[model samples]
Target: MIPEDILFEYNAKIKAFDKDEKIFSENEIARNYYQVLKGAVKMSNFNDDGKEFIQGIFYKEQSFGEPPLFINVPYPANAITLSDSEILILPKERLLDLLTKHHDIHLKITENLAKRLYYKAIIASEISGQEPMHRILRFFDYLKNDVHELTSNSSFKIPYTRQQIADVLGLRVETVIRSIKNLEKKGEVKIISRKVYR
Candidate 1:
């Protein structure tokens, strides 16, 4: 992600949002570059049956909704604040200019996009063909290894709730709870005071 000072130098502005506030809607024109300054945001969409499918959850210092800027398309999902949050936003033109002048930052952005693409590909495959346990493990592994940079076999506390995990993995919350218990019984994960750790 771009440094705070650099973003500010390029005229980035920080805006506050209440919990569950929509930062932008699906199909909205991509006119700004957004980075979470505090709290979190989830990029998601609802199905015809009103079931929510979460595209991704971004925490502090992470950027979201950038693919549209690169592709010249509208946002594919809605971005909503998960809590009272502050977000730094830069105009699309200014962001482009900032990237043009900062090669390292541009490369970093490209790398981040590539990581997201890889995650999407893996998740797509898992959802289409894998069992529930396999999907859950793969999802946790990606978040631990790729996103959190945790070493294999180390205990990593899951940051998301069961409902959030179910939404992200296209499963029901009850299924997620059952799977977590199964995983615990198999020693794949530990349930410590109702929190899951892997």
Candidate 2:
């Protein structure tokens, strides 16, 4: 559970977004650190050809935006709402001040950074060697580890569309569709009304 003091401190600054709305854009000045209180956010950026590629996804209860602040750079990616969402925003300076005063918060931040680094390593490895279908499968497996029984028939919801999944997996949209079709053919997974079931 999140610490109540953190919620109390930033409650007044919280913001909401509707699905597909931009929460923040790439190259925007890094001024706030955000904690996802509901729904999901996709972090993405455009390639030279102006095609967007997803960098990561943040689910409910996760925090983001501090890395760019710590690095003293504008935001590296665009943050977009995957669904109607609520996020708590604290000014970067206030967050830094909290870190300075709270040892536990500092440790939590360090652990978050470490987990991000580990995930980055996995993504890099997949980019270098894994096939797109395998990469997507691995990503689903990773999500399942965090969220038990993640299929549509289960309790939790998958908040991404097929095109969004394609972008996040670094595959052409057609490739993503075909991969899912193949998985269906193999009896490995099923897509029903745009929801994935395993």
Off by over 4 Å in 2: 1-5, 10-12, 146-158
TM-score, candidate 2, is: 0.82
| C-alpha RMSD values across all candidates | 0.9, 3.3
- On residues 1-198, what C-alpha lDDT tens digit does candidate 1 reach at each position? 899999999999999999999999999999999999999999999999999999999999999999999789999999999999999999999999999999999999999999899999999999999999989999999999988889997899998899999999999999999999999999999999999998
Q: For model 1, which pairs clash?
A: none
- Residue 7 deviation, candidate 1, in Å? 0.6
Best by lDDT: 1
Best by TM-score: 1
**Model 2 over residues 1-198: C-alpha lDDT tens digits?**
236467557452768899999988889989887888888888999889988888778887788766888988999898998889998787777777777887888897887777677667777788679988887776666566433435544533345677877877777889878887887788767677878865
- Could you tell me the lDDT of residue 16 within candidate 1? 99
